[model samples]
Target: MKTLWIKLLLWGYAVFSMAPLLVMLLSSFRPTADIFDDPLGLPTGPDLGNYAKAWTEASFSTYVVNSLIVVVSAVLLGAAVSLLAAYPLGRRRFAGRGLFAAYFISGMTLPAHLGVLPLFYLLESLGLIDSLLGLILVYAAGSIPFNVFVLTAFFRQLPYELDEAASLDGAGPLATFWHVMLPLVRPAIATVIVFQFVPLWNDFFYPLVLMRDESKLTLPVGLTHFFGEFQNDWGTLFAGLVMTTIPLVVLFVLATRQIVAGLTAGMNR
Candidate 1:
């Protein structure tokens, strides 16, 4: 009876969690009037027009392109840099190593918003304001501390024998990291990529502040175009949301195993 009750509770929680996503998916096929009339009800028929309007009229195509460029570049760049920074801190004993690791990890305690004014001035001075490159740089820099913290842990957990073996095989430091150590940490890298991708894709504040051109705006900021002073287009907005959400879902599904492995890696060690 206790097992059955626990199963029932788990199933209930799952349903509760999925309800909002189901509503969003169903509403994406509906008109705004129908959504207002029955917010929880099923769509009478799939309207397909909402997606068409959102894609063509709302310029989601452009937003998606910009988001892809910025987020992907930021994730890759941040992960590479974090890996480099983490390796020595994790594997090598050097002067000020602990202090350096603490310095990188310290960034996690400070919120990015607190430094906005200084960051804005710095970017402006570099003439990078309102550019995709500027946003990419910001995202990459912001993600580094967290990525370094995680990757450092993963690197530390790796067996030192692998490094010795690589060295025995006539590999240099760079070659050993790239060829051997890097491959072993693929799961951690995937975890970092997925974690960074979601936030960078959904971030609104930075893009709104930094980007001046409509064409350069990311999906999260551009989605606000669906709102009007007097009214809002709920259907198209939900459609846009569905489009925005799908990539995240697909990515999570694909990387779920890697994420699990990465998170559990140090536990057994």
Candidate 2:
């Protein structure tokens, strides 16, 4: 009886969580009048025109491209740099290594928004404001501490014998890292990618503050254009939202196993 009650509770929670998403999905297929008339009702038929309007009329294609470029570049660059930093901190015992590790980890505690004033001025001086490059740099730098923290744990869990074996095979440090160590951390890399990609893709604050050009605005910022002072385009806005959400859904579905593996990599150790 207890087990059955628990199962029932879980199913109820799942339905509660999924209800909004189902409403959004169904509303994307509806017209503005239909959505306002029956917000929770199903669409009479699938209206492909909402997607077309969102893609073309709303300039989501450009926003999507900008988001992809910024998020992908930041994630890859941050991962590479963090991997190099983490390996040494995790596996080596050099002078001041503990201090360096602490310094990197300290970033996790400091909120990025707290430094907005200094960062804004710094970017202005560098003439990087309103630029995709600026956004990429900010995101990449922001992600480093967390990436290093997680990857360091994974690296520490790895056996030292692997490094010794690589050295015996005449593999230099760089070669060993690239060929052997890197491959072993593939799960962690995917985990970082998924984790970093979602926030960067959805981030509206930085893009809204930094980007002045409509053509350069990311999807999150661009979606606000759907709202008017007196009214909102609920149907088309839902369509745009669906498009924004699809990528995240697909990514989680594909990388779920790898993400789990990465998170649990060092638990038994």
Ten contiguous residues with the weakest lDDT in model 1: 223-232
Question: Would you list the C-alpha lDDT of every candidate in the order shown?
Answer: 0.91, 0.90
Alpha-carbon RMSD to native, per candidate: 1.8, 1.8
Query: Across residues 130-206, which tens digit of lDDT does each residue of candidate 1 receive?
Result: 99999999999999999999999988988999989989999999998999889999999999999999999899999
The Cα RMSD of model 2 versus the native structure comes to 1.8
In angstroms, the error of model 1 at 169 is 1.3
TM-score for each of the candidates: 0.93, 0.94
Best by lDDT: 1
For residue 136, model 1's alpha carbon misses the true position, in angstroms, by: 0.4
Candidate 1, superposed: residue stretches over 4 Å from native? 1-3, 229-232
Over 4 Å off, model 2: 1-5, 229-231
Task: TM-score for candidate 1, please give it.
Answer: 0.93
